[model samples]
Target: MKDMTAFLPYASTANRPPLRPKLAPSGAGASAYATGPKAAKQTQTLRDNDDTELLTLFRNASFEQHFQPGSTVLLHGDPADAIYLVVSGTIRCCTVDSEGRRQIFAFPKKGDFVGVSDIDRWHFTAEAVDHVIVKSIPRLTLEQELAVNISLRLEMRTLMGGLLARRERQMLTLVSTKGPERLYRFLEEFAATRSGGGHIVLPMCRRDIGDHIGLSMESVCRAFSDLKRRGLIDLKSHEKYKLIGNAGRDATPLPLHADL
Candidate 1:
């Protein structure tokens, strides 16, 4: 597999740290760093040796399997036995309509976690957008850890919070913004997160982004055109954008970082 870093830009700030796989310990008596407010709060803790060890434990304690591009990792309503970590490659979480149209919920990159739903079954299907390697942690093991590990508890809490926040933001964009605004914001946010020296590589297709942002495919195309026209972004081609600096750029994009 290609080095995951090669596929994406580096973190923009020197102070920013790499993401780690370990969930912080949960339960009482956990360190303050492990616990978050009832709401999600962004934290920038570095990935330490402990976190690396935890990832190793997670991978070795269970088994890892590969899925070819277009393979389904979990179908909607399937039993949610384990949470998946994308060791490499991309996965799209999506839901299908009664008419059988697929609406992608999210495109998770390498190092992103998937299937963290609290329900016994998955609410959406997870399919490999590319050849994918996943480290699976049994749900029971995760639950057990959550019961005892304060740090993990906090980490999980933060993760849930971040998910909710992202969903809320997406919902607002769908309801309140036009297609061009949504697309511009999306590209701007993607660019701001990068090392500031390179273009943002979109891991998914325009159709996938359209579904997530509640835009029609044609509208998604128009939004890209609008951004390019405004000189906010260079449409390097479909699914790629180069930030050229524009007004009304996303403020949170550069500052936002997450563990999963």
Candidate 2:
């Protein structure tokens, strides 16, 4: 198959595609939207944090699914029923070859969406890396609703864009760089994620990371050792990693997106 990531930009989109905004800027054209209950809702959504907005969005979801650790959410050939919104826990997206080799593409966590595909059958399988809860909306429902909800439409588009960016980053970084750079990029991305109180916890195991990046477990371990030796990152435990600044980070590092 063709490597689509080769052509993808290693950085974030310089200018994202313009979405029709619900909140209009001040001026003559803003006359209709400037004052109303709709305008007040938009204003509040803007002022409120992302979690609040996400909560509001999920309140209207068609349904939800829960998966315990190691449970499958989607099979490779399963008919695409709905696009999923992750409420909690980690989802491991992967595929198994004819030889039964597992190649994981990504690990999407909370506040992420999955299962957007062009074909009716799923191209990949999604399983819970940990206990997972996801809200889902049927394809027909999303298409019909998105037409009316501008904000939801924009968000869904943004989610798709985020997936593209992540795949690009993953493939480009894995194939072009050594294990150290891959590890660094992974750490940097996760640092910005659920990390708090001076520590960044890695959600994937060494073997999973190795499989995802086409590296060996030994190589991944070596990369971690090298990072620690250079004081770039401190390994508190197998799962807990603390970022110590980008002491030896790549000058042109990849921007890792989570919603793959």
Query: Scored by Cα lDDT, where does model 2 land?
Result: 0.62
lDDT of 1 by residue, 1-260 (tens): 44432212211111113212122232111111122222222234335465643354354444466665555666655577887777777777877654345566677766778877654966676766666677777788788777787777777778879998988777777798777777767766556545666667786667667877788777888778776777667777676678775455486543222211
Whole-model lDDT, model 1 = 0.61
Q: What TM-score would each prediction reach against the true structure? A: 0.70, 0.69
Candidate 2: where are CA atoms >4 Å away? 1-57, 147-154, 246-260
lDDT of 2 by residue, 54-173 (tens): 345455544666665555666666577667778788877877554345667878888777786533867776766656677766677666766787877676667678889978877787
> What TM value does model 2 have?
0.69
Stretch of 10 with least lDDT, candidate 1: 7-16
Q: Lowest summed-lDDT stretch of 10 residues in model 2?
A: 7-16
lDDT of each: 0.61, 0.62
